[model samples]
Target: MENRRSRRAAAAAVALITALLTLVGALTAPAAAAPPPLPYVHGGQTVPTYSYADAVRESVQVDTHLDSDHDGKPDTVAVDVVRPRTTTRVPVIMEASPYYSCCGRGNESQVKTYDQHGTILSMPLAYDNYFVPRGYAFVAVDLVGTNRSTGCGDVGGPAEIGSVEAVIDWLNGRGTARYRDGRTASPGWTTGRVGMIGKSWDGTLANGVAATGVPGLKTIVPVSGISSWYDYMRLDGVPRATDYPGWLASAVNGRPAGTCDAVQSDLNTAGDDATGDYNDFWAARDYVRDASKVRASVLIAHGLNDQNVFARNFSRWWDALAAHHVPRKLWLHQEGHTDPFDIDRGAWMTMLHRWFDYWLQGIHNGVMSGPKVRVERAPRQWQQQADYPAPGARPVRLGLGAGDGGAGTIDTGRGSGTVTLTDNPNLTETQAVGDPNTARADRAAFLATAFSGTTHLSGTPTVTLRFRSDKPDTELTAKLVDYGTAARDDYLANDLSGIENLATRSCWGESTADDSACYLDTTEIVRTTDYGVLSRGWTDAAHHTGLTRYTPVTPGRWYSITIRLQPQDQLLAAGHHLGLVLSLSDEENTTPSGTGANVTVDLTHSTLSLPVAGATHLGTATTAPRLTGTAPAAPATRSTPTRLLP
Candidate 1:
């Protein structure tokens, strides 16, 4: 009996010890790491599982190295942020812009709204509303000298770029910022990954900031942005407008009057509108020269008919990015100075969501495994291609041959003769190309025979002329026109970026009483015209030597000048003719020199280079016979201006 009781006690003690050990192990074994809060992805995209209506909103002031206003203090820019309510870190999408207070942003011209305590209540566009619910933060920054920021606007100068760079630095925890309540603001909620996006001036800032090779910027989407300020205001040393930089600075400056007057004066003096030359002032704002420093992936969007920013801005930047083998994608549409969201809302949103997911959140969404270029051939008609300049495009050179009257021929073989045309500053492009078959004294016209099949022109065109001017200096204009009756986007209209806003509204994400995610629906403007201008170029005769140097023209001295037209992608159907018109002082596009100098061209020395895709030659050229007495008057049509923006 004693042995049995001792064994039973011993077994009970062992069971008790085993239960205690198991309990201790359960208590100490590092509670199954609460699955780090992360963005949820499904169907190859980040899902909108977070609540947009309850996102946290805040504001901060970032310090910049520049004192553009001469206030003896460093400038500080305002940044408005919206993020998910979670405690975990998230990636950022920033838009640095000067138009927040001056011109507003997006299609509806929505500006930033603030509360009584100076906190941001609403952002300009739908970016915050759409992205915040998807576990991303949206930052709307006011460029220095605009809105609530302190400084003077310098256009695209160093001060502007410095302001944007400072914000990026702060987001990366490399710089300093302060809240409105004077508390130090730290970006502890961010993962230090950022993507910049905007349109117009906002997009321009993206290009500028990305060129700086900032540490945290992972990618950028520049929509209708300028690559070079010199190209924006001038073309090959020809001024587009006088006092443009100063005027633009004054227009966008939101500070007190007279505070930035000195800055405006400096802009006028440094821009050198009188000389129309590329100087140090322009070199500082040229982004193409610094493209090699870009470390971020770029997705560029531009309108093929964008006259305000122009197509060359994107093309030159695209070429520079290609030379460096940078990761890039392109979206080209038929609208003018517009956003892809306004063109194709559903597709743009999908691509943008997937793009951010892949680049910012490190999601394996396969966004980069497709064709690199998407172009809209017509209204609402899109086509994807491997690359631009259409894969197999090659330059086809044609020599100009003088014919009867002012009519001329462009063919493969050179012809011997001289053609003369007197400059008329008052003549418009419409008047110059009117009744092109008959020709006019104010302009010289060259024609190529109708295409036998569909032909594509996918790149920039160059016009080389060997001419002698009667005066010391003169201005010249070259235009490539497509002669056909087809329906096309009417990009020259004065409406909102070639889109008509409808009464019906569409919502993208969650909405609040003060800030709604709904926006007015839009439709593209279309017109069926008899002829359309494919590309236009202008130059000052004195700039024949180089863009930086201006040599006075010697009377009767032959000068060979080359004018490169804007980039284009067009499909010429069967029976469509291509024409080149040469005139002086394009009244529709440039500031007329009013020199009225007569120019004589040597037909044998002049040539036209066209980028034709999949074509060995342009078939043949035939000069139209001289008209009898009076050529038939051109049909009355609406005038199309080359530029529609101020």
Candidate 2:
């Protein structure tokens, strides 16, 4: 009887202890959602189970300088966001642009739209529809002075950079935003990691913001973007395209016509188009100058034939990034002022997807491995390389021989002679390059032996000329052309509209009711030509001293200077001849020199060194043709003979 009573007491005590432990466990359990996965890699690829209609849509008013309305507070930058409806936080992809509310984005010009209840129905491009479903937030910011933001559109000024920084701060819970009813909001759903991507002006903002060394920004993809505002508006101490600052400002600022006049006036005064040299104003806009501040990895895509945002912009930026030891990638194509979406759609999307996923999602996807550069060897034909200015690109000098009449020989022998050309402001590049025999008195041509095998020009060519000018300042233009009988890619003329027929339309990524993920995959158009310009360089003899200062030339003294043409990656077939043309002015691209100077070239001291890939022997002369006269010659019926080197 005593043992039974003791056993019952022990059992009751144990049961009581178990009940107490269960109650304590229930009370101490976590009330918040589970933490994100460690090394968030594999999960980043899994599509999130979330409804687009139920996704969170919000806006933030980031504080910036220069309140155009005389408001007591600084101007507010409008940040529109769309993200998956998930309890767990996710990374963000943002694009800051002055065109979000206006001219739209990409070839189709898609803009942002809002629903009846003030919820965002769609965002520009297909980034939101595609990435939001893959567990990332999409933020679109309307640059100051455009859209709902307040302030003057200071084209790439402090206000623009500040607005971007503020938005980033807010995303990381360091700043503030408000709802329509005045309720405060925060990026509560964001993981604080960010990636920026865009094209043209939008990409320019990416370059600017990344240069700021903003804390949360992890990577940037600037496609066809400018690194220096001065490079865009001017070229080597000469105004580039006319009405640059004024026209560009007007195009970006969609506010009342005169609302941002004060800002416009400031831009005009600072740009100082008459004198094309670096100043304090341009210094403020130069992201390349501030590249040391960049902490984010960079991926740059640019077209070699892009006239708007020249490839030099990206090349310079790439050099700076490499110098700073920042992680970088490049996609140099053979198109003009275009997005990679139309060039190689599938590959572009894949690369971008992997890029963002690896950077933002902590994915160890080996994206940084493999080649760092993808160069277009031919139209839409890409070749991967470990680095740019491709390895083994040795400088091959084509020595200029004495002038035989208006024409000259480009060979290994140093011969004596001089060729003089008068400066004509109205003379066009077409007139100078069409037919060598028809070249005007304003230009001089030098011919090189044809290639025996396929040859590649992989980098910038330096034109070292020993010349004398008749005036204090004169403009000189150098063109490298591939003289051949074939159809040349007319990159500048072909439009991106692809096939206009509806049947040819196809979707990429995901689509929404307001915006289609579809685009027309257009075929590139080609034009037959006797010669195609491979590369070009321009300089003002005065600016040759330095881009920041002008040095006048002596009328009759010989001056030796090197003009480095824009970087290029062109392939010449076996029959193609390498032709070098020197002219007084490049009226087609820049403002006319109008200096009326007669430029004379001293042939013996001049040499052209091109970065030719896989060159063995210097080309041998197979044909010695007579030089064209001062007057235009009759149109030729057959192709001219071109020599080759083995």
Candidate 3:
């Protein structure tokens, strides 16, 4: 019996030893890594952990009609894309720009990067660096005729719009896309939804594309974009400063001048340099005229004082969108020709992120439920409202006269007077206000009595002059100014002038090995104890008959012309005065008409009307006591502005 029990114990011990050996093997052996989460859901706030280094980097060449190189085959537009490493399909955010190849983008001017074999490594502007990890594809397209593309840059013409449309078509499997080596590129990983965004010229492309009613485009965000190329170059059928179309085409084409000499010549002639009338060239590029074709939702941002693209571009576009009942929002600021990212990065990013997530991912995050318009109250102060131009703004006419209470008199009463001013090419805006004690023949000045309380001007103002010109055609310019004693933000002069020392450099968002991005975060300097030109407007007296057709004025015939100033949203402080400065020409910015003429105004029937936000009646107070306020700081060293290429 003892021998049988010992044999059974030995068998049990062998089983225990086998179990221990299996456990040891499992621990020592390397385990397989877990698979990535599948089927990424849209509108999810949690960012996925995808390796950016392993992200897909590629370029696609789409076909276009522009034979920029004069090759037999159709020219190609280069589209460089950076997307997530995952296989899940996602929407795209594209920026089609001519400046990508030459001037670059942002404050530091970063250009596209390529390898030795001409493979694109990265595109400009850190959009990919931020959105790729969030399951989005960032596409930087080289406008036809620029960079590695094979077309003559038309500077916002058919080639520009058609080339970008091809890319959207290719993504949706309606067109073709090929790699640099001529191999077919399959865009099966994209969800066929695209949102085009850009600032300045880039933004102008967005406006043009949206106006085409492209299928795949879901939305557009045009910052400081132009609605009409003609407006950018001319105002009221008159050249603003230079021959913009020909000059811009040459500026973007960085190749040998001989390569595009033919195109440039065509531009010069087609531009109608002799007569500043609207022709086929300007008609084809007017997006506002084609606003009916815009199906995609829009979110436009522009500075109120942007002289480069001007506020008229956005205001006119907004009016069209409203008429069409298109979904749209606006972010109007006080800075001049600047990006919101540089002014308020945190808020801009938050709003932009939410905007994309809602539009692209179909996230119902209440973005559409929010206010449709947000306007800048001051330099950095912002306010939200239901609509723009404040809702119920009306006009109040201020008559001009030649007597003591006449010049600078802005009231409802009509007065009789005759004032003559000649063209002065050398007259500065400061001098255009005219000496209060003396009369100047070079300009005419009319000032309103000091305000007794705060007043906001929220809409466009008009100056109707019943005057007779001594010449066949005359150049008339008018400026609206806020003459106050306290310090105010000089948004005009400080926009491109703020110099940031590297000592003040700061980083924005997550950084990667490929792109180490840092931006200048600083407040724009303010100029104290000065006058701010609220708005400026100009018109060719000949265009009053009709913008398209010129009606040469018979010399000495009295003609009534209405010049509309750029719209504004500004507060006139207590005791501050409003100045209406009229001159024959603006030497600093306007074209020299060379046709010297004396403009005589008949004050009896002429008036300047201002649209004050809430005033039902025009109030005049000459003895209003000045409100007390602290003095503004002295001007600092003028900072160099980081010029952005359009």
Candidate 4:
């Protein structure tokens, strides 16, 4: 029995020694590290694993290389940041804007709120609340000369573009920044991947910044944004508004009065409202020219009826991006100057989430495998297509034929005659388009016979006119009209912005006491009018040759000019007629030249080009319609007067 006990004790000692050795190895040897907290993925989307309520909120001042305000110091832009609380690195979604403090953001006009320490307590939109918990950071940056940034507003010039570029550089560790207390600010927890997004001026900044080919910027979603400042202020060679740049700069600047007087003055001078010519000043702000340098993928959203920014901005940028073979997607809605979120919340959110996941988080969400374009064919009715200008669109040319009264015929065959109309600067568009058969002295109206089959128009229309003006200079307007009684999205209603806020509210993401994710619901304004304006074009007769320089027009000299109307995607039902109205001085969109010139058009030399989809010909018209008596006035609406500013 004693021998057995000794053997057991020896075995116990050996067992104890082995266990201690293992413990020491675990404590002293290189430990097997616990995996870092990674984002969770399910159904091809990043799930909310991080706590949004516990997200880190902070502010920093990014140092820009410009002294736009000329205060003997380098300019700085204000940046408000909200990030997940995890220690793991994450990508960023940024929106740089000039409207954060003054005009506010979104349908509810939510602005950033601050704590006593100047830290951001609440961000303007639901982007932070919705994206933070998904392991992504949301950043709101003030453009130069706006909000707390120390600089002058350059009105889409170098200073504004550079300021935004500086922030992206800082995120990638190539630029400098600091906290409110003057301590150095470092984005140590970020992976340096960024995706930008915004609407109006905010989205304009995104387009400008992405054109710089800035590193660390992965993608951008520019909604109703301008690609060229010159295009925004001028069409062809006619100024949309006088001193527009200065007025806009003053409107958005948060600094004290006279702080940016010199800058604003320079903006007005360089814009050259008198000549309305494209100069070096305008070239610097044209992002479409630099599209080849863009490395970030682009996702564009614009309203077909967005007169504020116009459809050409997105269409031109889309074409430039395609020329470079950049990864891209497009969303064209029916509402005017409105967000897709307000148009179709669920679908927009889903598409946005997937886009960010695939581009920013490197997730294979198959978003790129879907259609490249999604257009709202009708109110709340979306159609997916492979490309825009619809795959089979072809231009059909129709010759103008003078008929009895002011009305004329449009068909494949040309007619002989000279049509004359006097310039009336004070005439409104409503009066110009009224009763096409009335033989108005100030406008010439032409109509096509009822269509035998449904016809679709998917691109821009061009009108070529050989005409003579009695005066030295005149402003001309061309409009494409759809004459029918039908319910349509009232882009002309709701202050020309195409939406009305409802009393009810809807919540998007998690909320805090300081910031709620609920925003006022919005609905599309609808109106059933006898006729709808489909597209319009404006031009200065002196700019017939080029937009770069002004050529004086000699009285009685016939000039051939081509005007490109705004882009459109419309489906004309059978039995509906298409009409074209040519008039002088669109009082609604342009400042009248007041030349009062008598314009004469040779019908045989003028033609209208339509981008008809899936059709080789528009089919000839038999006769023009002439309705008697004055047309009925449109019903009264709650729409406010349209403004030039977005």
Specify the highest-TM-score model's number.
4
In candidate 4, list every pair of residues with a backbone clash.
none
Per-residue lDDT tens digits for candidate 1, residues 52-122, read 87888999999888999999999999999999998878999999988887888888889899889999899
Q: In angstroms, what RMSD does candidate 1 have relative to the true structure?
A: 8.0
Over 65-111, each residue of candidate 2 has an lDDT whose tens digit, in order, gives 55654546688888889888877788999988888666888777777
The C-alpha lDDT values of all candidates are: 0.84, 0.76, 0.76, 0.86
TM-scores of the models, in the order given? 0.91, 0.87, 0.88, 0.93
Error of 1 at 518 (Å): 1.5
**For model 3, what is the C-alpha lDDT against the true structure?**
0.76
Over the full model, what C-alpha lDDT does candidate 2 score relative to the true structure? Answer: 0.76
User: Candidate 3 versus the native: TM-score?
Assistant: 0.88
Better of 1 and 2 by TM-score: 1
Q: Per-residue alpha-carbon lDDT of model 3 for 1-646, expressed as tens digits? A: 8989999999999999999999999999899888544444444552545655677889889876556556567978888988888778889999998887688887667788887767777666667766777778888998887887777777788878888888888888888888989999999999899999999999999999999999999999999999998777777866765556767887888556587778777877887756678888988889999999999999999888777787889988999999998899998888777777767777887778778877887767777886898888666678987777887777887777664422445556674577887877667665665344245778776766667788878888999999898898878898887767655555546445222324476664445666654666756545565466789888888887767877778789999999878888877887677777788777555564657888898978888888877853346533212222312212322232212245
Q: What is the lDDT of candidate 4?
A: 0.86
Off by over 4 Å in 4: 1-37, 627-630, 633-643
Pairs that clash in candidate 2: 450-643, 498-522
RMSD of 4: 9.0
